[model samples]
Target: MAIADQSGRTVFITGASAGVGRQTAIVLAAAGATVVLGCRDLAKGAAVRDHIRAVTPAARVSVVALDLASLESIREAAKQVCAEHDRIDVLINNAGVMRPPRSTTADGFELQFGTNHLGHFALTGLLLERLLPVAGSRVVTVASPAHRQGRIDFDDLQSERRYRRSAAYAQSKLANLLFTYELQRRLAVGGATTVALAAHPGGARTELNRNLPFLFRGASWGLARPITHPVEIGALSILYAAVDPGALGGEYYGPDGLFEFKGQPTRLESTPRSHDAATQRRLWEVSQQLTDVRYDALAKSR
Candidate 1:
């Protein structure tokens, strides 16, 4: 059932302390990939490394602190990773915050959009050079079924207006899909082997939902109980996108069961809006302006 061993691969996964990212890291390590765990908290990252070692004594796991709320921290982390490794075979943008009390990132961007989208956007651009030079690197962004109901408000990408917590989150996740799609387009034009793809967990029980207010937490749990799959199972779709054979340049995947909230990894349709190349390109430009991270820099030499 697992894909063939990825013995020589190096994987960088964010939010590796717990939940889907943690489980996905462990699974990748078990598949013989050397995994770099990116965490907002160093101690938590170390604990994950130790736990992986306990279970798979020979697991190659390293921890690095990456605070998605701070662009400087993300830059430093990406720089350090590039300095240490010759190439990263896969980059999983799995770390993200959900519905935190209305707040802003270090750069003053709204938390959900900043941490979930812009942070990863900047990091990806920073590391694009390293990944593209490698033979077949892939970037996998974890999105959500909630994106189905999202509309990117160009007027207020940060939700500076009409900020409902849920809406902000939807916008951020929608941004994730847009970023993934645009990256794939650029990778193709640049003639790079590195691929960019998107996948969503479809409401598996992960800590991503932990930020919800207590009442909403209980309510969500009750509402999705029977249909919600285990976090570990939820990780399969991401892992599949990360290492499965014949992975495409721009594809979206989710659970193969009811409402895509449960069961095995399988192809799932993205909302028609998510497929709009023009909107994706516009969002890409806005992201560059906001984060001051540019993918075109990767194009300059090529």
Candidate 2:
């Protein structure tokens, strides 16, 4: 798919300090979009902004402080963003945490689930008003193949019973897909122009694995080397969902190679588990209650 020129568009991307999000921000900014980098570290985000500006002198880039683990931080960042931008053309829920030592967010939810799923959920809901009024606006979330291994154990959504790093990560990724599909349904029902979509990078060489145990990280890297692609390539699936005019709501994109590990981005299928309407609705309700940010505009038809 040919990427549409984003001239005059405003794009807000989380985790823009590094990896897929960083590359996505650069590409869109280079294409003439006013890109906002939502980073936990302002210094890192400013550095990325400077780097992009140095290369594309005409690029309009801004850095906003964002920490997905803390609802306070998320709300402040969203408020700052909405106060500054009248319309957001694309909001990429691209930030995520991989397998880390068991921990909790400020809200006491599991780290991976809170930061990766709830954080984006709240941010998207807060920013929906900005997106809904804009024609062709999109919410492109980054999920993963790890979702196939995930099962949302509502009995212990926070891993209070058992906390396996891989399981937590998988659950979070699955939640991403669920949120995308549910949000799309609500948007369509409300007759909104903003759409929701998802994408995955497959095996990308990024710092997301830095939190894994040393031996496991080294072994996995060695074994996965043949399947892993560069960060630029990883960002393609996300960019496709963000800019491709043909991409539609409730769609997913990933690599075209074997096992979807590498190569060009293309439309892909997710597990049937990710498509459960009942689970999606339940998760959405839980997310709203947890985040305290309501998608009232999209909820009228629900």
Candidate 3:
């Protein structure tokens, strides 16, 4: 429960309508941070705000419409955020979808890759200026252990050649880490004070797995009761990355327990492949080309 006090900070969280995003928003709001819930569902977002307010009567909370499945929504959300807030202390790319039937985003990219990776890539690029001006600002992107199973198929990045739901989802999560490390590298090279970090919930009990195979979903639900903790616990890794004074850019954190399935947030290591510089660079370039949103600070600094 003891975490950094973000008393006067501004935190913008994506997918705050429910799950870990919602839990993180509440925690930050309770700590007196101005919490902006970026959600695609206004009604669900309102309910989350009400919950936060009920917990902390003086909570500073607001909601902006955001749909990670659409590049247009990301732009509008970023604009609304910048128009309203002078600075952003932290931006949490916490919203995501799990293994779903193969689909494409509004931008016509693979659903998981578009929403989970490209959406955030564009959002962060568009909002980098707002973060750069604020000392110690951080951007935390959520990855998953499933990332270990991911392989970036540049030839078929959208799974147009072969589509396996689980593999696609894993690839997207891997993209998150690649994006985080690449962003951190750019931020440091650009002489920017802001940092980019990544975290994983370590198998938290959330609705992200609702799209799994029905049999697996039913069986996992029963087994997960003992292995998976609640959203709050899963959210600690994110809060730690967002506010932990010792947290470094490009570092990743997750649970510290058995197989990293459940435990308190702790510094965790990702797969060796996730740290490949060449792949990271390639992914960054492709992401820029796909999303069409470039990080200006890096270019200006270069």
Candidate 4:
């Protein structure tokens, strides 16, 4: 897929030190977009920025410190980004944790839910002012097919009652979809030019699985190796959603191959549960309250 020249566009991608995020950053930068990498480790992000500059000497790439596991870090990162950049053409909420052992964020929320969903939620809300004023700006979130098995256990959102790594991960991914759809609706109602969309890498061979147990990691690397694609391919869906002229708000993108495992990027349908407006609205309110970062500009439409 040929990407259009992104001269003058500015794209911010989280978790960009490695995996699909890193690939997306490099590709966009090469395409002439000013790419800002949001990485937990400043050193790793600087290395990636240096690498991009080395290969594509004209590529505009910079690094920002972002630790999604901590709300304070998220706030500081957003502030730093807003202070430096006047507008954001694209904000890719691509950073996330996979099926890690049960843990909690600094705010005490489940690790997967906090870092994957809530962290992006807060960041996006905080940066709405920057995005709202930009024409054709987009908030593209990265989700997973595991959302199919998810059920938002509102009763135990933090997984305090019980903890299953896979189940928790599924819920977080589902939240990602719900957030995307809801954000799109709000952006439209608020009459903002910014739009929200989502994409999934399908079975991409990324470091996201590093947190999984040894047996599962072995199965993923050995048994599931044939099904997964490289990070470059994995980032295609994200790129399509972020820059495709035909892509629309609220739309979902993923691989086109069998079970969406690997292939070209294409429009895809999310599960019906992901489209439930009621749940989406509920989740939005809850997220705002939990994160204490309100999208007042967007809420004006409500």
- In the range 1-302, model 4's lDDT, one tens digit per residue, is 89999999999999999989999999999999999999999999999999999999999888999999899999999999999999999999999998888889999999999999999999999888888888999999999989999889899999999999999999999999999999998888878779999999988887787866664364255466787888889899999999999899999999998888888899999999999999999999899999999887676644
Q: Report every candidate's CA lDDT.
A: 0.87, 0.92, 0.90, 0.92
Model 4 residue runs over 4 Å out of place are 213-220, 300-302
Clashing pairs in 4: none
lDDT of 2 by residue, 108-223 (tens): 98999999999999999888878888998999999999999999999999999899999999999999999999999988888888899999987888888787666435424655
Report the error of model 3 at residue 166, Å. Answer: 0.8
Clashes in each model (backbone N, CA, C under 3 Å)? 0, 0, 0, 0
Clashing pairs in 1: none
Give the per-residue lDDT of model 3 (tens digit) for 122-178: 999988878888999999999998999999999999999999999999999999999
**How well does candidate 1 score on lDDT at residue 217?**
62
TM values, all candidates: 0.96, 0.96, 0.96, 0.97
The residue-by-residue lDDT of candidate 1 on 161-190, one tens digit each, is 768888888888888998899889888887
- Candidate 3 weakest lDDT stretch, 10 residues: 214-223
Estimate the Cα RMSD of every predicted model relative to the unseen true structure.
1.7, 1.8, 1.5, 1.5
TM-score of structure candidate 4: 0.97
Clashes of 4: 0
Question: Under the 3 Å rule for N, CA and C atoms, how many clashes does model 1 have?
Answer: 0
